[model samples]
Target: MYHNTKLTGMVVYPNDPEYQQARMNWNPFTNAFPIVFVFAQKIEDVSNAVKWARENKVPIRMRSGRHALAKDFSQTNGGIVIDTSHMRNVTLDKKNGIAKVEAGIRVGQLVRMLAREGILAPFGDSSTVGIGGISTGGGITAIQRTAGLISDNILAVTLVDANGEVLQVNACENSDLFWAIRGGGGGNFGIITSYTFKVRTAPSKVGIFEIIWPWNQLNEVIDAWQRWAPCVDVRLGTILEAFSKANGLLHSQGIFLGPAAELEKLILPLTNTGSPIKVFVDEVTLLEAIDFWAPNEPLFDTQNTTWSSTWVKSSLPEDGIAAIRTFLERASGSESNFFFLNSGGVMNQIPPQETAFFWRNTRYYMEWDASWTDKCETQKSIKLVEQARLQLKPYITGSYVNVPDLNIKDYGQEYYGDNFERLRKVKERYDPENVFNFVQSIPPAHICDEKDIDD
Candidate 1:
């Protein structure tokens, strides 16, 4: 009964030779074993897989690039994992400044392809992260201030819902679903198979700079960066990172749409703040700037790590900066560090209630992660990340959905903020049976007494 002709595509079973490799996650900490993996090569394959899963009564999890930070974010112990890495197709409409892309394309591949046409699409730091997974959860990139989030650039999407029906969702049709999927988290409302994004023109060369200060100057650097980054010229996008004491680094790097001379002039306030060890600024190709910010190799990465993040409503005071320094000092691994992204400009032009992304008034986004290679260091690393998040809760407000953390109890509020309740209602419409439910997946709205649902 389950061998339906529509269930087409490469399927890997538990006993298959490729099953072990196919089921591997980008993050090694998320240990899971799925019954099967349906590698979707087309929209029909996605539809068929959903129908088959429904008949077989198997829970389904959506996976692409396998880079979900939270455990169980993209896989399950005894479920069907729909892996959409085979559908890498794109149609570029340069005249209209639009790019229609398949769901499985990684951020790096897409950006490079568009760069050849002199088009700049918003993308994240990692080259291997899937656009579907990240964009659906509000993709943040270095150019976010100038271009807006990846979600904001989306003009439309092709989705396969819980009922095995393919639907075209946009501002006109299925409008509510359109708003919900943008920044509401992927696989919560439906399976997005393709997206049409509004891209922008790009200069052949832009200003790029990297400045580093001694580890001891981190506190002052943090304070100076907080004041300057968020309010910098919209043409420039900035990021600062503080490595664990073991690495002894406090680096600030960014890109300016103008020449290196202009960028250098714009960043004098930061350089003049404290004693600096090294400063470099110059004109570079957009691809070169993308390569410079990349931390991991442009390939599927496997590492044991735990991550937690929150948005800053205001600048962190001296005490807050001290707390960040103290917690980061506990990290001993080379990969452990605290990262920051300046927020504002085009990303904030839309108010909170306009879309599922609610943290529009944020100053910057901050996240601290702990990494370890030794099995002996696992517990300590995870515990440190959790404790660090709790300690810094006073300084941060909302959590980032793409960078999921199971430790956050009130995840609905933490991830979606004021948009949580409306997201629940959209979940009620598209996935009323909760067929796509997971740890932090939105649940259908409950029509009951307010008292019964109070936290």
Candidate 2:
């Protein structure tokens, strides 16, 4: 059903050699085949692609860094895929501390460019992730405890709406669209061409802390952390990342932002709670720390792994921790444990209702992930993952929309929570025709009556 017409940007088809790379995303399980691919070069190219897809009744999939690991949400079989990779453009203004970045810019690329000019924007932990996708779905960064979500620093955005009209929106202009793009969801309202964000001076020195604890002592460590991690001062950002070790040891990597002596002071309580197998803390430049936190190289080649996330008020209770230990210990040990990123510092200081991101009161946001390369072990990983979820479901307040599992039956409850209705109204006012549609994308209020059944 897609038209073969080409606009300003180049178009690729299924037979093209680059098709495979174009259709690929961060999620290994997602392999899609769109009828055509638009390598969007300019803002007008994006608008033309949207208009073309709408007129041809073709489903459109918007992609930036392809970091969305969820299936269905960004996948479209035999549909039209709008590739934003070619639209890379960055403008930096040191005098005003503002940077205008095209949606296609990668986190690492942005950091490298800004560091040259003595400025940096707060973004996700990964370097390859595109600013476009992360900003729309509750962007949390290592510095989030100090600076808040990436959306919080956004000054304005230029979005090409469903009607093929480019609208420059911000707090003072097209405020509703601005609200939706901040935390509602990307690809639902429009294709953001560029975003203007207030940048800050990069921290000259940052401290990172890593520790490995025995599996038997996880409860003591997590419980102790639950009480102390949230109360840490705003200058120090901390995270309790739990993971299984290849050497048969369970590890908890704690990342901190401050001097080495200061980091030691913050982690002394955790060390006293449980003896760790190995503990290392050091100070590094902000750029070097970002490289240290970037995902490993082999990660780029792995496929078929599953990731899920949910926000929690505090550490999982004793019963919840016991359930997790049981699941991780008995479930083949192939799956990694969840993480409680401390989010109660500057993150909580922002009022819950200020922007679309509503987890301000929550002490921690947890990411449940299960990664495996063996096709046969998929079932084992999935079952154990579900077991972990079932145990922690009662304690979960909400899920991050970006890291959702397509298999989740009720998405509204998992992602948007109480803000679903308000998001629906924003969608109605901006994308009434559903021209900007994806498999699990939010629907406008007028059309939500039909789609709500699926939710």
Candidate 3:
């Protein structure tokens, strides 16, 4: 029913030589085959593609860096994929301290680009993740405690709705849509073509530290971290990762906005209690620290094939650190790990109702993940992740939308909390037909009974 001749963008069909390259996602576990992949080079091209999909009654999947953990939301079988990978362009208004970034630009590329101009934007830890996806889903980074979430810096967004109408959303214009897209998660409201963000001056130097403790010291190290990291100087942010017994690694890493001496003094409590095997702390340029936190990966290399089927569940760690230790003890895969991201300071300053991201008061955000190479080990890895989620449920406040898990039964309430109704209303306003939909996407509230909701 769809015709390639009617499409404006570069369309790659199944028979095209570059179809597989265009359709590949970061997660190899995704088996969905798109009917066609449209590489949108301009905003008009995106609008044209959306119009084409609507006229042909085809499901549309919007993709940028293709790093979505829940690939079902970014790819679809027998559906059209409107990929914005070709629309990467970044412009900065140095005088105004604002940057206009295209949707397809990777976070690492943006960081490097911004660094050249002595500017910085808040982003996730992954170098290859698309700014479009992360910023729309409340991007958390090493500097979040100091700088706030990536969404918080967003001044405006240009989106193409289901009707193929291009609308610029900001505080003064299309204000409601602006609020929803800030942290409502991507591919729900519409296809965001570009974002205008309020950027900050990059610090001349930042302190970076890494301390590794043996598995036996997990409890002591984690307890120290929970008590100290979140409440430390707002200029500091930390992450704790507990690798499986197969890897036998428990490490705590952080970046501080000030010099190494200040960071050393503040982190003394963490260093003294854990009996760490190795501890390294030093001051480096902001760019160097960013690279240290998240190293870059080759964008189009499928030969090595690093594939992971991941399930993530998040919560505020109160009494859950012990349960996390138990899960890590029982973890079986070579790459299974439990990650905790320190969340307080500037991140907590934002009230929960301001944006769709509701876990503002959380001290630390925890994630349980499993990764494997062999398909034969898939079941075991997924089961481990599931078991960890079930055990930690009692201690967790809610889950993060960026690290999505299909196993979540009440995804809307769990991800958005009390903000689901407002998000649904926005979805209804922008996409009344529900053309932009996925397994865990917000459904318009009028369609579902309010009594059925348990948030």
Write one digit per residue (lDDT tens) for candidate 2, span 300-385. 43646666778778667789878766765654444466667777777888886677776678877777666777789788777777
Q: Give the TM-score of candidate 2.
A: 0.93
Looking at candidate 3, the ten consecutive residues that score lowest on lDDT are: 303-312
TM-score of 3: 0.93
Best by lDDT: 1
Where does the lowest 10-residue lDDT sum fall in candidate 2? 245-254
* Model 2 clashing residue pairs (backbone): none
RMSD of 1: 2.1
Cα lDDT of model 1 by residue, 186-276, tens digit? 8998888999999989887889888999888889899999999999998888889999999998999898888888899999988897988
User: Where is model 1 more than 4 Å wrong at Cα?
Assistant: 1-6, 295-298, 447-455
Predicted structure with the largest TM-score when compared to the true one: 1
Residues 69-105, candidate 3: write the lDDT tens digits: 7657788998998989888899999999999999999
The 0-to-1 C-alpha lDDT of every candidate, in the order given, reads 0.87, 0.75, 0.81
> 1 or 2, which is superior by TM-score?
1
Residue 186 local lDDT, model 1: 89
